[model samples]
Target chain A: MTTIITAQNLSKSFGSFQALKNVNLTIKKGQIVGIIGANGAGKTTLLNSILGLSVYDGDLNVLGFDPYSQRDELMKEICFISDVATLPKWIKVSEAIDFVEGVHKSFDRKKALAFLAGTTVPLDKKIRQLSKGMVVQVHLALIMSIDAKILVLDEPTLGLDIIYRKKFYHQLLEDFFDEDRTILITTHQVDEIENILSQVIFIREGEIALEADMEEITENWMVLNPTADNIDAARASSPASEQSLLGRTSFIFNGVSRAELEKLGDVSRVSLSDLFVTLMKGDNDA
Target chain B: MIASIIKPGGYNPFKALMLREYWENRRAIFTTPLVIMGLSMVLIIISMGLLGRAIHIDGQSYTLNEMIANMSAQKAQNISTHINQILMVSTLPIMIGAWFCMVFTALGSLYDERKDNSILFWKSMPVSDLQTVLAKLLNVMLVIPFVAIGFTFIFQIFLLIVGSFSTLGTDYSAWDLLWSSSNLPLLVFSELTYMVMYSLWALPVFAWFMLVSVIAKRSPLLLATIPVALVILFETLFFHSEYLARFIGMRLTGAHILQTDNGFGQNFSILGINTPLENIQSAAKPEFWIGLGIAAALLYAAILLRKRSSL
Candidate 1:
C-alpha cells in the first residue's frame, strides 16, 4: 500500500471565509475513495487543491510532486473530470480527440476512438450540439483512455439520467480501475457510488468528520431499530444520530459492539449514506 | 512506453498547443481572409470585363487597350508602378479583416475559456500556463498574420495573371508592365518583415488585451479599452499634450516600424521601392525596446493571473 497523496495541515481561504480548514489526509494507491460532504463543505475546494487548480497554505504532495508549482509535470500521471459538461462546447468530437492525443502523453487515442465507436456521439458534431448525457459520455471516453495513475472526479455524473450515471460508474469500474490505479471522487449522490468505494471520508464545515474503510465502517457502525420502551437503553450507547418514523426509532451507533446493540433492539448494518448522515450530524452537533 | 510515444521531437508540445489555438480559432484566422479574397477575385473579374468599354479619366477619353498602347515607355512605366500600387493596396481590406480578427482573438482567447468554465479542462493538461499564454500570443502575432499574407500574395498573383490577359492587344507587354515592373519578391519580403516588426511594435497593445482577458470578470473589451481612453483623456485635460494618445496610435498603426517621410504614405511605398529591405529598418529607439519590455511584463502578468484564476 503505497501512499500516493499526503496532506498535512492543509488550509484554504477566500477573503475571510475559510474554505478548507486545517486538514490532514493520506490516500494510498489501489484504493477507490469517496469524499462525501454537503454543499459548501469544501469538497470541491479540497479536490482543487489536490489537482493544483487552487492555491493553498500547508504542505501537500501528490505522486512526489507539489501540485501547485509542479502541476504541469504532475498532470502527466493525474487525470481529472471536474463536473459533467466541463468540456468546451465549441470543440468538435474529432477535434477533441485530436487535441487530447496531442496534449496528453499517456492518452490512447485508439482506445478513446474505440470507446466512442460504441456510443452515438457523432465525431463530426460539436460538443454543444450533443445532449448533456452524450457530452458526459464523450468526456468520460476521453478521460478513461488516459493511462493515468490517479483519476479525480468531482460530480462527474451531475445532472445526468440514472442510466447514464450507472453506465459511468460501470465503465469506470470495469475498464478503468485496476490495482495500479486509484480514484478519488466527490458527489452528492452517495448511494450511487457506495458499492464502488473502498473507503469513505465524511467532511463537514471544512474538516474531516470521519474516515474509515468499508469493512471498518460495517464493523464499527450499526443502525439499531429500538422499540419505544428500549429507546432510553439504546441512547446509553451514545448513538451518533437518531431518526423516528411511524412510531419506530432508528439510532446509529458508533463503536458499540453488535452484542450490546442487539440487547437493546434489532441491529442492522449501517449503510454508507446512513453513516454519512450520522457522522455529519454528529459534527454539526459538536 | 508512453514516453516513447510522446517523445520530444516526435511531437513538440508547444507546437501542438499552437495548433490547438489555430484549431479553436480557425474561422477567424483562416476563413475571414479567404472569403474576402474570394469576393475580391469576383469583383476583379467583373471590373476587368468592363475594361473593354471607353472610359473618361481627368476629361480624357480612351478605351482601356488604347490607353495602354498610346503611352510612352517612361509614362507606361509610371502607370505600371501606379497599377502595381493599386493592386498592392487592394490587400488592405483583407489586412484590415485580419487585424480585427487578431484583436478579437487576443481579447477572447483567455476570457472565453473562463466564461465557459473550460479553463479547468485546459489547466488539467500537462502544458503550463506560460506555454498556453505564449501559444495564444504566437497565434495572434505570427500565425494569423502569416496566413493572411499568404492568402493575399496568392490573390495578388491571380490578379496579375488576369491583368496580363486583359492587357492583350496593347503595345505594352503585360508581363513586363505588370509582373516585371512589380518587384514581387522584394514586395513579399518587405511585407513579411513589416508584419514581424509590426507585431513587436504592437506587442504592448495585444499583451494588454490578453491581460485584460484573463483578469476581467466580464466585458473584457470594455475593461481593455477604457483605461487607454482614460489615459488619453487625462493627458489632454491635465498636461495639454497628446503624446500618450499619439504613441498608442502609432503603435496600433505600426507607424514606428519604418522611417517614413510621412507617417501614412510609407506603408503604401513599401511596394514602390526596389530595395525594400534597406528601407524596412525598424525605428531604433529606447522606446521600442522599452515597449517590448512592457509587453513581456504584461504577458508575464497574464500567465500569473491564469495560474491563480479558477471557476
Candidate 2:
C-alpha cells in the first residue's frame, strides 16, 4: 500500500504546553483510520498539523507535500470537513456550491448539486437557515463531490441525531470510499464508526498510546471474565486494564494467547470503546 | 517569483477569490453605493422642485428656464460651472461612504472568518493565504472604488437629464451650458486615476487594518486604531511633533495629490479640467512611493499572520 501521510518526530506547542509530542505516524492510502482521544488530548492538533491549519516542529508530509508550507498544493489532493459548523453562516447553499466549484478544480459541481438535490437543504437558503444536521449533510455532499485522494473529517457529524449520524457514515462508505481513496475521521461517538474503521489510533496527552489494525486488535486483544480463584492466573498475563463488578472480575489483555486466556475463564473480544477507555485509564495510572 | 508563490494557477483562483469576496460583502461593495446614489438623486429632485417654486427672474413669476434665458452668457457659464461643481461635490459623500466601507470591511476581513471558524473552511480550499488576503485587500482598495465610480457615473447622467429638463424653453442648451463646459471625459479619467492613486496611498492603513484583523483576539477595529492614537498622543507628549498625525491625515485624504496653486476647495475647476495623469505626475512625491513600500511590508506581515492563525 502507498503511504499517503508521514510524520516523524512531529511536535507542536502552544506557549508552555505541548499539544503534540514527538508523534511519529504513517497513514497509508485506502485505510479508514479513526483517531480516538478525549478532549484536549491533541487529536485536533494532530489533525490541524496534517491539514496545514497550524505550524508544527519536525518533519510532517501529506501527499508528498509539506503540509505547513505547501498547503495550497497539498489541498489540491486533500479535502477536509472540520466539524459541522465551519461553513460560513452567511453563505447561501448555492453560493457555497459555486464557491467550491470555482476554487476547487477537482470539484464536480453537477455531482455536488445532485447530492444536494437528494437532501432537504435548500439551494437558496443561507447556512444560518439550515438545521445543524442539514448543514453537515450539505458539507458532506460538497466534500464527497471533490475528487480528492485523502479525506479528513474531524467530528464531521458532531451533535447530529443518531439517525443522521448512522446515515452519514453509511452514505460515506457507500458513496465516497474506494480503494484509491483514504479517510481519516475523529468523532466522539466511537462506537458508531468502530465497525467501519480499518485501523484505530488512540491518543492520550499529546502522545500515541496505542496504534493497531482492527484485525490485530480483534484477534490479539481479549477480555476475560475470571472467577475469584482464577483471578491471579489472569493477572499473570499483564492485562491492560481490569474492572470488578458484582463479585465478578473482568480483565482486558492486549497480546496474551487465546488458549492461555481461555484457561483462566470465559474469554471474549474487547470492544473498541472498552479498549479505548482501558487504554486511556491505563495512561492515567501510568 | 511572487506571482508564482501567490497564485499557482495563472488567473482563475484570483478571479474566483475576488468573486467570493464580492459574494460575502455585496452590501458594502454594491448595494451601499447604489443606495447612496439613489438618495442623492432623490435629494436633487426635491431641491429642483423647491428652487422652481421659490425663485423668479423678475416681479412676474418665471420658472428656472426663464431665469437662465434672461441671464447673460458669462453668467450662464458661471451658473453651469457651479452646477458642475455641485455634481462633483455630491460625489464626496459617496467617496467618504466608500472609505468607511473599506475601513470596516478590511477590519473584519480576516477577523470575522476566524471568529466564525470559517477560516478553516476557506483554508481547506486550494487557495493560499496570500491569495485570500490579497483578494480581501483588492476588494476594499480597488474593487469598491470602481463600484463607487460606476454609481457616480450613473448619478451624473441622471443629474444631467434632470438639469436639462429644468432648463427647458430656454435658449441656453443644458448640454452646451453644463455638459460641454464640463470636460467630462477628463473629469472621469482624472477621478478614476485619483481613486486608484488614493487607494495606493491609503494601502498602508488598510494593510495595517488587515494585520490587526488577523492578530487581534477581539475588537479588531479598536485594536487597529488604539495604537495609532497612542502614537499620535506620544508624539505630542514627548517630541511635540505633530508630523505623524499630519502624515496620517494626509495619507487618509490624499492631500498630497491636490496642487497648492489650485487647491481642492479653492478651485472647483480642478475637478473638471485637471487630467489624472497630470495630477499623478505633479503629486508623485517621495511620500507616495514610501507609503507604497510600507504597504507592501504590512501586506506581507498580514499574509504571515494569516498563515499561522487558527480557530
RMSD vs true structure, all candidates? 3.6, 4.5
TM-score of each: 0.93, 0.92
Q: Which 10-residue window of candidate 2 chain B scores lowest in summed lDDT?
A: B2-11
CAPRI-wise, candidate 1 is: medium
In the order shown, the chain A TM-scores of the predictions are 0.97, 0.96
Tell me, by DockQ, which candidate is best. 1
Q: What 10-residue stretch in candidate 1 chain A is worst by lDDT? A: A277-286
Native interface contacts kept by each candidate, as a fraction: 0.61, 0.69
What candidate 1 gets wrong by more than 4 Å, as runs, is A283-286, B1-11, B50-63, B66-73, B261-276
DockQ of each model against the real complex? 0.59, 0.56
